[model samples]
Target: MSIFNLIVALGAVTHKDSDHERVLIKRIKAGDNKALEELYELYKSLLFGMIISIVKKREEAEDVLQEVFMRIWEKAHTFDENRGNVYSWIVTLTRNKAIDRIRSKGYKTQEKASTSVDEPEFSLEGDKFDPLETTIFSDRAELVKKALEEIPEKQREVIKVAYFGGMTQSEISEHLDIPLGTVKTRTRQGLIKLKNILEDHISRNG
Candidate 1:
């Protein structure tokens, strides 16, 4: 699957492992390190892929991935199922951390010193993805493609820049010449529409 497709597919299959992940997070909240490991195993590929897409460096991506889980282990208590599902929460968390890493001075200096600006850091053209992650994204991309196309173009633009382009809201605002609040509004609205579409798809598929 294309990185674009997989990034968009991040939370599109909310029903697949919802219950089991929720149980894992609950256990994690209650001080179960093993549950955290289980959660890490369950999501590492998908999350790491997303992080590498943002940071564009394998080593930095790996460090950010570790920091991401540490944050999860520390803040698992803050996960609110009433607001969103576990998948979306963790995806957002991973994306935010990745963005933060790229914005750091250390990352900027390292990036400036690197001579591989022309080379791709991560590629899905080979056996880079775990077979199961590939399958999950492939199955959901078909389901999400049409629904994603149905949203307003403006909302879709911001969503694409935020997710696939790995740009934060402030950066997106600057890039698109829109106010930061407008960018946030469009992103939230687009995601709400997408979430509703996925939930409807889940019900019908069942």
Candidate 2:
């Protein structure tokens, strides 16, 4: 079956038999590799799409998808149904792992450098800055600063280093001596929080 078909089938099965999911997890925890495979087969595409959304790279997303399943295999015993459903747990884990991979020093540095190299040539002398553009930029910067102030201090710090300092995610990780994965998570979460704050601010003020 196609991946989409598989996802739909799995969704139907999970929705129809939540108990079946719990049983699968229980079996997986009890050292059933087959159960783990079953879980992977069910969720791989959904998880892969999520990873691709965060990482924006197919190859890296694929790598992260593999790592996510590996994590699921090793950490299945830690899954607690009391806290959340299995689908939620797996999706969260997949997203977190993909964010971690993209936030790595190596991946960030390579991506940033490649992006910089791919831009078309532009001369400052040939293209003079417009006053309107400057004012708009300034306004946006102020709004962003205000939004940043609302998030936690650590997230604000990472966001500033990333967006203002023009540093790659990996660079931020190295400069702070923080783990690459931690940097990635912070960056992703911080940006999401910032976006929400900005949207709310705009809605109220606009």
> Which candidate ranks first by lDDT, i.e. highest?
1
User: Mind giving the per-residue lDDT tens digits that candidate 1 earns over 53-99?
Assistant: 66767788789999999999999999998877777678778878987
Q: List, in order, the clash count of every candidate structure.
A: 0, 1
lDDT of 1 at 149: 81
Q: Candidate 2, residues 1-206: lDDT per residue as tens digits? A: 22122222333333443677889899999999899888887766556555554565667767898999889889998998886667657755775686577668998798877753222221122543221111112344356556667888988778656532335778889988999898888877877887777668667775
Global lDDT of each candidate? 0.73, 0.63
What clash count does candidate 1 reach? Answer: 0
For model 2, the stretches where C-alpha displacement exceeds 4 angstroms are 1-17, 116-206
For model 1, what is the error of residue 37's alpha carbon versus the real structure, in angstroms, after optimal superposition? 0.8
RMSD of each: 6.0, 14.2
Give candidate 2's error at residue 174 in angstroms.
18
